[model samples]
Target chain A: MNATASLDARGKSCPLPIVLTAKALRELNAGEVLLVRANDLAFVSDIEAWCKKTGHELLGIVSESGFLEARIRKAA
Target chain B: MGVTEEALLDDPSAEPQPSGVFETELRRLSQRVAELEARQHSLARSAAQEDKITLLVFSNSLDRLLAAFTMATGAAAMGTRVSLFFTFWGTAALRRENVQTKKSLFARLFGWMLPKGSRNLPLSQLNMGGMGPLMMRRLMKQKGVASLEEMLALSRELGVNISVCSMSMDLLGFQPQEMIEYPNLTYCGVATFLERAATGKMTLFV
Candidate 1:
């Protein structure tokens, strides 16, 4: 999937990844997709719930070799 | 024997025809269920409507302060409004290092005995004469975890409200000028904290 912006939150622990993702999303326009990469396993469920609560659209999530990548579209 | 009564007695599995009173009772039960369901829905809605967290920081230990700040920043990151009310010993965490203000003899002595700032706070357990905090800070740095100071800075950047208990400050002789500069920092009494906490979805004392 194509993303308008990307964030590398690898090696960051819980809350930091989610925190940085929220910060990064603020810079994107509505409907713009953000690709977030993180190693924290909690980020998967955390981002899913965060998106649901914040009204963002989670396009997809993929687990790479050691990191997980999530695509999220900003809410309009 | 009446046909309906005979059928009910002979075939216990038979469904009884609803009489006027039975029908009325069934309707009443169905209505009650609907009302309960509606009430549940409204309760959940109200729970979700509250998105603020209020934390009472009462401990000045390094470990406890770390937990408090971590929770504050974590909640703030998830779009929740967070307020930290520092009281008593916790207010010492906000003191600026090497910044001294004139105070009464007892207050000056109290300040001298307490940790100067976030960096100087000792560990609550396994302090080992102040070596524990040093070891913990080094471990956090090596593991890419944020230290207490970094978390404090991040909490400020994240717009977490920090309220210093004025009564605690006055007792400890800590002046507002001696505290670290932070955005949204306020000096207030317990009433202010209680008022904000009333509307908060979560309140913690640490």
Candidate 2:
């Protein structure tokens, strides 16, 4: 799926990746998609809970060779 | 409609007469479901009240300050509203100057004894002649972890409310200009902090 924006947070730690993702998500219009790359192990569950708490839609997460990619859709 | 329990009880020619047991079981299950729903409703209401984290910064030691900022940033990142209330020695952590200040006799003695601001904060233990904090800072950088300064800055950027205890400021004789310039920083008393803490989901004293 096409994403409205993409962010690379592979090297960043726990809250940093989630914090930056939130910052980027806020700039997008409702229903837009944000693709995030993170290597922090906690990022997987953290992003999931973050979306659930923030009312955003987590489309999917793909674990790559060294990192994971998450696609989230902004809520309308 | 299905055969009513009243009908089954009232009828003298009912088969087996097992309606009493079935009705009791149904009543118990309905009561359980209602109890569960009520609990869910209360949880939903509490969640709707919004999440709040109150961090009481009572110590100005480097490690404690790091812990406090980490807590604030972590909470803020999770979309929880955080308030960092600096009081007592914690006020020294927010000072802008890293040097000893020449103020009143007591203020000057405090300045000479306590570390000034985030940068000058010493480790609470294993200081080893000031090398402990220095080594810790270096180690944090080597590990690619954010420094205390960076964490504090991130806390602010993440919308963590930073408040200085006005009573502590007065008692410590700190001038307004000596404190760090945080955006929309509040100088408040303990009563205000207590009110916020009472409503907060988590209240921590560090």
Candidate 3:
């Protein structure tokens, strides 16, 4: 079973949400999962674009009560 | 036709050395020269961009960029002509709406856990289950980046122009005309911002 980590980065801004997610993802080996909880509207597009450009897998995005959560898998 | 005596003596047909290798070296040298010229052009462009009044966007999460804005605005005070155009959640840092004026004794009993000034209203859409704002505050303390309210204060002290988007005003339930005056704020529309951005030499979308 692969390990998983989570980062709550809701109110943070553009570079930060991405910066922290990358930081957390860095700690995990390839094929690991990182769940990012954020409500920043820009994060949805920014992260998706980041994942696409970097070859990471953006597992999914879902709207919750006050924020959005993104599931991402570290690129193998 | 213009080949010098040295070139004639260095002729590739008479020698065993590879002409292809020499051609490759010439091509590589030309490419390297072109790359150097391109880099110089980019630097010149960047400096030129910095020389004019740049419009910066405040959409991202970290307050470091805010700090940079404050610094630039401070520099602008000595006549740099800097301006900030806030849209979306970035607008929260400029207004007093929905800011928590009260805090518990546990965080800071004598006064409050938050700043006495207007709370940099967290953008509603990116609340991060409320943790994102919390983390930013904690990290601000750890990193010594100024908090939203504090930056608001410095912005006032330094005379930085803070404009809140009128369109955002409608979406966020903020009445621009009724909003508190932070000494550095103004409520305006897209055209208002365009007037500044269009004429200014520097304009950045956050």
Tens digits of lDDT, candidate 1, B21-75: 4577779999999999999999987676468999999989999998998889888
Q: Pick the candidate with the highest TM-score.
A: 1
Task: Write candidate 3's Cα lDDT for B28-109 as tens digits.
Answer: 9999999999999998875664333645555534443455564444344333566777776555444444434333444223
Model 2, residue pairs in steric clash? none
What would the TM-score be for candidate 3 when compared with the true structure?
A: 0.40
Label model 1 with its docking quality class. medium
TM-score of 2: 0.78
TM-score of chain B of each: 0.78, 0.75, 0.51
Model 2: per-residue lDDT, tens digit, A1-76? 6999999988777567787888899899999999999898798889989888888999999999999999999998
Candidate 1 RMSD to the real structure: 5.6
Specify the highest-lDDT model's number.
Answer: 1
Q: Specify the CAPRI tier of model 2.
A: acceptable
Worst 10 residues of 1 chain B by lDDT: B12-21
Candidate 3 lDDT (Cα, 0 to 1):
0.62
Candidate 2 regions exceeding 4 Å error are B1-48, B98-102
Q: Scoring model 3 with DockQ, what do you get?
A: 0.02
Best-to-worst ranking by DockQ: 1, 2, 3
Is 1 or 3 the stronger prediction by TM-score? 1
